[model samples]
Target: MSRVRQILDMNAFDAATGGDGAVKRRLDNLGAASVLFYREPIEMVAARGAWMEARDGTRYLDFYNNVPSVGHSHPEVVAAISAQVARLNTNTRYLVEIVDDYLEALKAKLPVDLSNVVMTCSGSEANDLAIRVARAVSGRHGLIVTDTAYHGNTALVTEASPSALRRSPLPDHVVTVPAPGEAAYGGEDIAGGLRAAVVAAMQTLEARGHGIAAFLADSIFSSDGIFADPAGFLQPAVKTVQAAGGLYIADEVQPGFGRTGDAFWGYERHGLAPDIVTMGKPMGNGFPMAGMAARPEHLAMFCEDVGYFNTFGGNPVAAAAGRAVLRVIAAEGLQENARRVGAHLKAGLAQIAAGSDRVTAVRGAGLFLGVDLGAQDGSGAPDADYTVQVIDRMRDARVLIGAAGQFGATLKVRPPLCLSMAEAERFLEAFAGAVSD
Candidate 1:
């Protein structure tokens, strides 16, 4: 079996080698906790639309960052944030019109049953709150996740994120099942196979004296190599978890907000009404904001035991930024754009895969796609080193991308939603050259 790769180690800079003055200054400041992308990290200065400009004046088409989901430095979002902060920036304690307005607009997009929304500064805090709410409502302590899932970075969330752990084993309260993919479950029936894995995991958790509180998963399985296909394949596993007295926490940090194209939320594509939904990263078009939506009763139950508050979670500035994102997504018709452009991009990638043995597979929905790299010897083994080479090649060609999956051999292709056809074609050309070389 291939060695499991940590999420942070994928295409990361080697701090030991020590970089130039700028890199050295960054390392000195952030130390070992710093996670910089690429072997030679680029000092990004500015970004707009689908491209980022390095401090050295080279412009690279960004196909890796999902945080700026709509586009980089979107004018509307920037204006809203600036306008709101200039007027007033306050927390949830006070009655703010924009804050409630944003919440109401956001709630309309969510399942009606999830009536209460709690905002947070990041996805990590949102997930941590969701887990607590699930445990409170389900009256259980165990959790289940996919083998290479990366939920968040909080102390509690890190324990559940298998891909984030480099040396420590998964805590007993946490159990992992294989990711929902053809590799784990043959193409015959992915739904049934994933359901069985969840069942087995629940059994194991029960045996360990920790009844399953929640079955948490990134709806698209982004970190587990983006296994999004057959649309409703997740329903069976989700239903099994709910029937087993466990809540389903949909971690939409990566795949939410119309990135999947077909639906506003990734869970919607799977036909799921998740018990709790936690979202961030793309919530505010690069603004630091995240939120958890749950049934009012669930939030009430959790609140009875402990109080939850965030000083800057849903401040007016974040609300303005979020509202702008929602408005831009609708006004610009970004969802439809994602669907159309994503299809074009996927087809181009499929052609590349057909021509190259090193390109093993192409899968995912909408703008969130994953391309698996393999050994060139026809054995089709996952090749991390070759993947890094391709990443560097793409970088040299002025295209930015990153790696994911258990072996770090899958290129995570997630450009902004505003990516034009010309940009998609440009990426394909760069990708073709990267792989061919």
Candidate 2:
């Protein structure tokens, strides 16, 4: 058998459990279960620019992970981390120039008013802190989020997450709105659905006689389909949230820092400024660092009374790594690369879709894109079964991407911002072959 197939076959067995079906059986025993139920695994051993080498040394183009934003093992980021660790890697309690220096550089990227910063160990913690600050400032207990959004797997976050929200039970104070599909969720009326979802949330709140804390959402709904219809989709929703006594929180874990091409933040493409912005994933370029950026006043309540202090939140090593990433993004013009390379890939995919029946259309902005397959009625959505088969075939073709959508039907194509047009063409060739097969 071929190497990829061999690895796929091995995925059914639990290496630790020592038997076929053992992993599934054990997971079933746990009683809490929710997975797309795909049966292939890519055992990654090494990573470089825009690719991952399997344990068997098989190469594959990477287009489904946003965590390694700049590129895997970027020399500058690695060097900065190494140099910092050689001197110091202490906690937030200590006064350090690296911490403040890193803050200054990061704050420079945003609008001047969005100055104050607080660090967290991960995106989930960043989100949690954002929520706390918003609640403290606004003095509201209720929260809001779009349906099918995936913030994190934390207790509070998951309750706000529509991706896995219905799978479990939690507080009713979270006002849920539909993600803009324009057909599936609320067909042909993107503006109406967005407005309706927010309006319905307000109605729900009034019925319960409650107020809202914050409207938390990804600037780009990564877990859902890549783009949620037209530009400025979330502007109406943000206005509704604020009017309903809530603050707007833009979750930048996936689409922040110019990955979305046209704007620095995915939400900016939608034409609204968030009150709070939570960042993670590429913030430290896989250094386990995340942070929240807010206006000075929102932080004032928490900074004095609650007092934010994290053990390793803004440590010297993590701060240095972050500084390096910001520098590289500007110096290397990666955000512009995302624009050029993503446009090339989008054009190629559209050209191919015109010629083939396999792919229906390409959706999303910049490197953050989705490939939807043709349906029987000429609709673009590839059913979950076909999406699984396509992703499986692509993996066999030595390309590594993943499935998104409520049922895992959308082929997620968010590669690192450093991906070049040559690599994009290479990916398109492999993808074409996979579809033809």
Against the true structure, candidate 2 reaches a TM-score of: 0.89
Provide the RMSD of all predictions against the true structure, rounded to 1 decimal: 0.7, 5.1
Q: Which structure among the candidates has the greatest TM-score?
A: 1
Total backbone collisions, model 2: 4
Tens digits of per-residue lDDT, candidate 1, 1-437, equal: 46779999999998988877899999999999888999988999999999999999999999999999999999999999999999999889999999999999999999999989999999999999999999999999999999999988999999999999999999999999999989899999999999999999999999999999999999999999999999999999999999988999999999999999999999999999899999999999899999999999889999999979999999999999999999999999999999999999999999999999999999999999999999978788899999999999999999999999999999999999999999999999999998884
Q: Which stretches of candidate 2 lie above 4 Å from their native place? A: 1-38, 184-189, 374-382
- After TM-score superposition, the amount by which residue 49's alpha carbon in candidate 2 deviates from its true location, in angstroms, is 0.9
Q: Rate the local accuracy (lDDT) of all candidates.
A: 0.95, 0.77
Which residue pairs collide, candidate 2? 142-213, 182-187, 182-188, 183-187
Model 2 over residues 1-437: C-alpha lDDT tens digits?
Answer: 11111111211223333223534554566534423223644556889888888777998888867888999989999999999999998998889999999999988877677899898879998998898898898787777776566787678777777665543554778777766765444546676677777777877866776677788888677776676448887788788878767899999988998898888778878888788889998998889999999999879977777778889899999999899999999998998898889889988888887877768767888889888764545555456656667777777877777766555566788999999888998989888877773
Model 1, TM vs. native: 0.99
For candidate 1, give the lDDT: 0.95
Q: Worst 10-residue stretch by lDDT in candidate 2? A: 1-10
